[model samples]
Target: MTSDQPAATRLSELLGWRKSPDPGLTWAQVEDRLATEVPRGVKDLSLCFPTGSFGGWIHFYNPVQSERALDMFLGRAKTKTENFKYARSLNHAEFPHRFHPEEGGLVAWGHGDQHTYFWSSQPGPESVLYCDDHGDGWGQYPGSVPEFLHALFMDELETEVLYGQWAGCRFFTEFPDYAG
Candidate 1:
């Protein structure tokens, strides 16, 4: 799908999802908690869709007002700084990633099948960063969060690491407590 297309529309078409389930939660609270602004499309996607896994392999974190309380977006993003610091210490100096508020720091958004997705928090536009199996290697997708997710699930993007983590399947399974 193109950037002109709305993420919910493209994703619904591609995934055969028929509902746009919004819980009417404002993003202001979530953003306040993170101390960083989440991309519009990313917030829209989270709010518009129910909590679920794609092909049981990838999951956008639970929405801001998730009732089940697992994997809340702000919780994950807030912990990124600390997690990355430890990761850098355990690994090496050339690890090449920092948490938000620092130049080129990364904000963790989603993870599944040992693969993590992040937004490179910088001065200009944000890009999706992918790390496979929590390994040292990195891949950058120069697009919005929705675009990366849409393309990844649609087989329009070739992520070498993704191929190993998941078979390209579009099946979506909603979480049991996902209010729809």
Candidate 2:
């Protein structure tokens, strides 16, 4: 439910993730390039996991690791903005979001099959949010980024928005390789 440990520590102990050997990306670099303030936990995550799959399901983009990945995420977010606006136009009651990049909304951090994870950039209590591809399945996640992940690894965070992408899968650190 909550984590008293540091975000990186919890992530390492639980996921056995290793930080990249290269110099980690700095806040200045991110700000200069992305022009968006990434969450602290997310920054910490890059120090360790950088770019990797979580539980063999979700792929986290490490902005500092590659410009292409960062550009891809930005592009996706931009596209989502237009798409969500169109969805809202269809029916404000059903699709009532302007994406995060619009009016100080949540910033997307990662995504899995049919699900995208976001962090609230607004004031007040911090929390996470996710929306499925259908635009109908949406929900909030409690805790900081690390805590949310801990809950997810422990099978405490519940929702069908992921469309069972993580079903029957235990948390693993890198890409799953069978052929190699």
lDDT of each residue in 1-180, candidate 2, tens digit only: 126767666756776554452424556876566555677777766666655678866767666665555665576666666766787798787666556656666677777776777877676566778888568778888766766776676677778665443335545454322111
**Which regions in candidate 1 have their CA more than 4 angstroms from the true location?**
1-4, 67-71, 78-81, 101-104, 164-168
- Highest-scoring model, TM-score: 1
**Residue 141, candidate 1: alpha-carbon lDDT:** 88
> For each candidate, what is the lDDT?
0.68, 0.65
Candidate 1 lDDT over residue span 28-88, tens digit each = 7566756677777676677556777777777766556454433465566666666667787
After superposition, candidate 2 runs with Cα above 4 Å error: 1-3, 21-24, 163-168, 173-180
